[model samples]
Target: MKKVLAILLAACMVVALFACGGKTDPTPSADPTPTAATTPGGEEKPTPGPTTDGVPLGKILEGDHAGREKYKIVYMCNTLAWAWNAAIADTLGKLGEPLNYEFTAWAANNDFDAYLNNIPAFANQGYQGFVLGIDDTLAQASMEACLEAGVSFVAESTTIMDKDGLCIWSSVQQAQVKNGGIAVQWLYDHWKDYWTDATLDGQKVGLIGLNYSAVSGINERKPGVEQKFAELFPDGKFFDGDLAALGTTGFSAEGGNQLSTQIYSQNPDIEKWFVVAYVDDWAIGATRAAEQQNITDKTLVVSIQADAFLAEMSNNYTGNVYVAACAVSSTEFAIDMANYLVATISGVATPETIWPEWNDAGGSYPRIQVEGTMITRDTYKDYLAKQAAMLP
Candidate 1:
């Protein structure tokens, strides 16, 4: 009825607060100062968890708070099965002990009732902050509940907006349009080399965009790639496997492989393919499909999040079809959430205060988008070295 999965996803974040730990042993980066504080109810910091050197605040903030005086708070989010979510969850697991944070991550498994129930459960259980990635339409009641409970809140992936088309809370993640455009820029510069024997009239070159339209953060990625492809190759043929439209989760690499296989199979003439995927898993799927069809040399893929790409040690560009990926740096994003929440609770920053960038840009609610960066096989080693230094 559906597709398949290849994730070695840990059960860590599939449940509520304080349930599990990360697979990593990340230590905190050296700090100019050591942190020592308690949560507002005089609760202690340093919960039982992994150690982490924090990403460092620009300066020791002046106050402990959002409007109340507090040092730290419990942070939670939905879903750990997804790589991005898992990375965030792992960071939470590591940072809590050193930074005085109480945090957890897990999925609701698409059960809306179970998802909505956590919002109230979090408040009832004394949690003071959350980074939620929820359905926009279903967010109002939960968002209202968080506001009423005085929970410092941040939206993950997409900003929670009010009925009047205004944002209600700060959001974390990349600018969707720009994130997609990264794929286009890479494809525009590189597609030609891959299209050597292909011809537009012969229907040999196909541009495929893998769509995950269910979430605004991901859905917004498709248009940027599509619009750019049209302008650059006016006669090009583009195809899609809109997973949301097809009523699929759009996550599994195997699903990606199956969907892309169908696309390539139907258009047998499409020998040179360029796949722009919203995430790494789908991109890997498309790459696998190209390999299976023996067109690896003529296919190229670019997507957001280098999670899977980093796991592969081969020369991903020359040795494989998947070429590039972008990262929101799950580590950095997780740290920013902690910093912003503490800054708000300690009275140094307002709910509208733009973190990391420190400016609201005149928006009612802050939409803090981590700039995305392209990573290729050529540079993954450096990225890995940096990760090693940070974690060790």
Candidate 2:
């Protein structure tokens, strides 16, 4: 009986040893793949979502209007006989169908009274939208008439006061101001060290003001440069004492040539000449005048608005022509306004004002401020390529 009890105790001891060994090293099972072990500080990272730089998705989605009915819009400009008119016509043509709209242009040929008289005529013709490239003097009354007729009105490159709910103003990216400031800043950055210190101190920068009678954009741009120069050089002489006025009408080149000739004749010592004109056509005229006197090299010509011809000249002359910046045509803004009108007619929330106050710093607007490209001879090829890419 004692031997039988010993046998049972020995079996119990053997079972206990097997159990302890299994906990330390278990036997391999049918599925022998090892499981992944978690580390002491293991963590699973989450995936990232999408993002835009700063523009809200709501603003991006705001102006979309699909399957809307067609609408008729009349675009009025102070002078319908120029490149600007062509730009407006082309822009409107592109906006057709997609926005369901047709634009008719009424050019007043720079006559303020004629522009005012044509408003009611256009409204009577069943037009719903009116775009005005107005003379500053006629803005208030024309805007008032538009409000009275319940026709939505938009002004390009200018604004009229006292019409809060009636008018939308498209602000071109202050191209005139930007171009002027850039030209001056370029001179300061690149050529200031070259000028004799004494000459640089008293250097006279002459501004050739164009369309003094009718052009508002040119007028605003001149003051921007003047103010910038004042800020940069507190005691610098801004040769405002010399003013050469040119008309944008027929013979703009001739007018530019005549004015430039007069300026050179009166103040030959002027070192830098900043032209406040719409295009290189005026600069071409000034170049002709400089050629007549064999003085092209003496003057540093800085002008706004660059087309194919101006771009080529900038390449050839290098430092003589100095800087060329673009004041992109108002045509794109006209197209945007047409699209906005279609959206508004379709009951979408549209801006009451064309040039909203927020767009002063290149912000949002029905009439967004389109910026100009600044080009020098070194950068002309790249500028041309970019403009070419935008064609289609």
Candidate 3:
């Protein structure tokens, strides 16, 4: 809440998760090369031409209450081939009905330069609005392109930050600080069932926060949990794992597995592992590695956005290894973002009136953040019931 926008998303790298944190550097430290990631589960995306190929540009999903002017918008993300982005696309597509707009789901494939390039590509092509799942390194340039074209933008998964690394503008992302802090507290409270404070303070357990240092959006997921952990266990030996080194698409389970495996192999003195992650794919991957190593007994992982894992959470990734997650409805997220983008573009809402209240916390931006629910194996049904209520 100090400086990053947190609201309205959870998926891609399973993108669309809550993004909170500052922009320390314009460029992320990871390699920008596009790699394959089969998560959130659907078909795979081709090297995103950022074109109309897999991207369903100008496609209109059937809807109701017509007679309104239709505008073109784009949901530019890492890839559409994966399930994470696909569900969001479907939800965005449906907004055409009562909201009255068409869209192109541009799969950018984690290419930073491509974001710079394609903003103009589609802007010149008459795309009037954009919902981006990207970092703020290029926020200035991206904003410039939109300004030139008279295009409106609403950020998802990633908040657009200012030159000062403070959040700026409107975004729909997760509650990074709130969720991170709460998850740590939950993990700590649950851990009390088996371990004592002296044992935790004794340095027998190690903490790992997995992230791609380059993707500032996903990195937001860590600070909340890390801050809470530091307060609880001052001597906690926390390891920050850079999944960028694994180099699979930004947030893949495979990348997480490789990173956690390395962490486990390298840290021999640690008796237990507690991992904090954002996307379900990465958490699932980390859980896979922990289970394979037979360390779930001592290791517990919690993550945000259960969309990717919900399909199979009951059958797999059960128990305390992957433990709990914060679930947000993709349908609900897209609806909120689509409405905000169109409303802002159409002048139906402004910076002053977009959010219901100004005192609401979401960094320093005009954010329409969606709250998430924490669910465990014991409360999966409750989440499902809650998820069902939001169905279109």
Candidate 4:
């Protein structure tokens, strides 16, 4: 079953590459200069589709109406404060232009009740399908509401357990695990340069974790990072930052800043940090704390969600200390998701057969895990260059 899915996924990726006009060169670097020249502000564009002359790119209909108007779908975001989330919402709305669907997004501003309330409200408006940024505690309610309304659903970033949802999509957990390994390897390679007497045995590393109680995908990533660290340096010390405590204030940049500050004060000797957060604001907050505490030169942060930190990562000052990130393109994911929902609604595929992860019998929810890109200064610059070429 897994093998069949792998072939299908590979075929999809090949199709994606060709759709984007093909891949770039074989190598990318840590330097900020791009191998290919870039057009200004064109970095990381979304996947291409039939947007020519405003003709909506609806798929060839076969089952019911062969040549009809596009369907309507709506998306609800958990919060738009995080740039990545906003980008995801925006991309979905725009991609509908070519895909023969009406796409709209609503922001819940991280309010749990607001997030829960919006689901039924959106469904009541006659949307055929919904793409949701999930809050696990409220997911069952949301799913029930959609079911009652007779709307098909697709969830992102988190999964709905034991529910009959169409699909659940998120960034690959294995890439996040590999992100931890990359963090450790980077520290090992450059330890001597940072500290003359630095040794792997007693070196302290701090982890800033995302709250993962009901969010299993993120919960799974934490152990992978920890296990890899243990494998690489058995005697190294690790400190964990309290994510629940951080949420007391809020979940925005301010909350992140306060949490990082408190963590830094408690673990003053820790020089390296690994953030198991998909939101870039948390990592940026940690860097901001490093600056305020006058430890910028002595600290390094390895994290996920690179788009929000692209500008900082490209600059020499912040770039040096920021180290690396695991990047999942919001635009690409949004495009993939929009198409998946359209395909399911159009009767081209079912939820289980849409992607491979959905076939796992033991898991309560069917899902698709998409891999991410590694972002260093050079690779980020290279990404920008490639995106520029794809324009026009």
TM-scores for every candidate against the unseen true structure: 0.77, 0.67, 0.74, 0.70
**RMSD in angstroms, all models?**
10.0, 30.6, 14.2, 14.4
Evaluation by TM-score, superior candidate among 2 and 3? 3
Which ten contiguous residues of candidate 3 have the minimum total lDDT? 22-31
What tens digits encode model 3's per-residue C-alpha lDDT throughout 184-213?
A: 777787876534443564476778887777
lDDT of 4 by residue, 1-392 (tens): 99999999999997764333211121211211111111111132232233321111112212333265677787776655456666666666665655677766666655778777767777677678788776666667777776777776777665665556433332111234444444455555654664566454345665555433334544545665566667766655554544555444535556666777777777777765544443455667777777787876666665666664675664554444566666655554565567667766776655555543233344333344434555666567776665333211
TM-score of 4: 0.70
- TM-score of structure candidate 1: 0.77
**Runs with alpha carbons beyond 4 Å of true place in candidate 2:** 1-66, 163-176, 191-201, 204-214, 232-251, 271-279, 308-319, 329-332, 353-368, 378-392
Best by lDDT: 3
Q: Give the whole-model CA lDDT for all candidates, comma-separated.
A: 0.62, 0.51, 0.63, 0.55
Residue 216 accuracy (lDDT) in model 2? 65
Comparison by TM-score, 1 against 4, better one = 1
Per-prediction count of colliding residue pairs?
A: 13, 4, 14, 1
